[model samples]
Target: MGAFDMLSIAGSSMGMHQTWLDSLANNIANVNTVVSTSQTAFQTQTPIVRALAGGGVEVAGLALSDPNGRLVSDPGNPMADADGYVRAPEDDLATQMTSLVMAQRGFQASVQVTKDAQDTYRSALEIGRR
Candidate 1:
């Protein structure tokens, strides 16, 4: 592929990673969300990424986790059920943190690729000038 194509691929990857990071952040933010047992709990969102045939990445959609939240007993809470149990989001903080780190690394790598491509293009132009 050409330099422009490489840049496009890297740019797409960066955008995809950004989306992933945003979703992870949302999941983390709602990790402690609680709801009545009769209602659905906050579901963790995951970005669906797909490889394009033209050498770029695309965000297909988001996948939501099952509504199987953890049941916690808290009799004092106002939102607790008849059994003094509330449903908490099943989001795992550790897993979300790890995913965030991975997404950050991927974004950084894509930025580096974009920078390298720009540098290569600049060098080629300088050679032509000479």
Candidate 2:
């Protein structure tokens, strides 16, 4: 691939990683949400990440978690259902933390790639002028 293509790919990778981070943030924010039934549970969301063989990257879609929300029985809870059962999201905090770390790494790598490309171009210009 050309240098421009490398830059574009790296740029797109950074964007994708940003989207992933956003998704993870949203999931973490709603970790305590309560739903009445399986159909209405607050599902953890994950980004559909795909790699481009040639250049760049694209987000295909977002996937919803389905491991089943925890059925907590609390009659006094505001979101409690008629049977006193609340569907709390089944989010694993440790898993989410790991994902956040991975996303951060991906973003950092993309940024470094773009920066290197810029430095290479600048060096070439200096050589041409000399």
Candidate 3:
């Protein structure tokens, strides 16, 4: 509606994208995690974003991906099961990388919006002072 409102919206978007990027990074970091058969494998985390009433976004919660991971046969590994199989996180590196790129772009767009809004406000103030 207003310049300030636009800035608020951009700020909220930036925050939401930051959360998304953080979750993506976490998922990527644990992509190669190996766990014992008895232990649960690292589950990918996704940020749950929701639109606010006025005009903004918020991270409502975190959604965990399926806990079922891939089984890797490693006879020499200590954490392997009786069948010499270890559970590895089912994280897809390609998907995580793609999501990371999207989030980065979203964050950059929001930053640009905020910067533009600020510049417009500054120019208005300068014009008013003239």
Candidate 4:
């Protein structure tokens, strides 16, 4: 592969990581979302990534957590059912936070790779000029 191919690979990785981060953010944002029994609870969004045969990665699709959420007794909630039951997603905050951290690291690493590749290409140009 050419030296510039590293930049393309890093860019694709960064894009995939960004999508993952977005999904994680959405999941975290809806962590406390509660719905009436008549409605389905919010589902956690997960990005499905796949590797390219040539190089880099891509977001294939999004997978959602189970729709069957746990019931909570919240009689005070306006959306609560007649029995004071509300549906909340079964997503775990710990798991979401962990994924967020990992995705951030992956994005940062990809950015670093892009910078390194640019620096290497620039140094090579300087050597050729010398």
Task: Specify the highest-TM-score model's number.
Answer: 1
Q: Could you give candidate 1's per-residue lDDT for residues 16-74 as a string of tens digits?
A: 99999999999999988999899898999999999999998999999998897888898
What is the clash tally of candidate 1? 0
Candidate 3, residue 89: lDDT: 79
TM-score of 2: 0.85
Superior candidate under TM-score, 2 versus 4:
4
> Model 2: per-residue lDDT, tens digit, 1-130?
6758868999899999999999999887887777665446788888897888887888989998875777889788866778888887777677888999999999999999999999998998999999
Relative to the true structure, candidate 4 reaches a TM of 0.91
Error of 4 at 59 (Å): 0.5
Query: lDDT of each prediction vs. the true structure?
Result: 0.92, 0.85, 0.91, 0.93
Q: What digit string (tens of lDDT, one per residue) describes model 3 on residues 1-130?
A: 8659999999999999999999999999988888888888899999998999989999999999778787889889999988999988776799899999999999999999999999999999999999
Using Cα atoms with residue i matched to residue i, what is each candidate's TM-score against the true structure? 0.94, 0.85, 0.91, 0.91
The TM-score that candidate 1 achieves is 0.94
* Whole-model lDDT, model 1: 0.92
Q: Candidate order by lDDT, highest to lowest?
A: 4, 1, 3, 2
Query: Which segments of candidate 4 are over 4 A away from where they belong?
Result: none
Error of 2 at 44 (Å): 1.5
Considering lDDT, which of the candidate structures 3 and 4 is the better prediction for this target?
Answer: 4
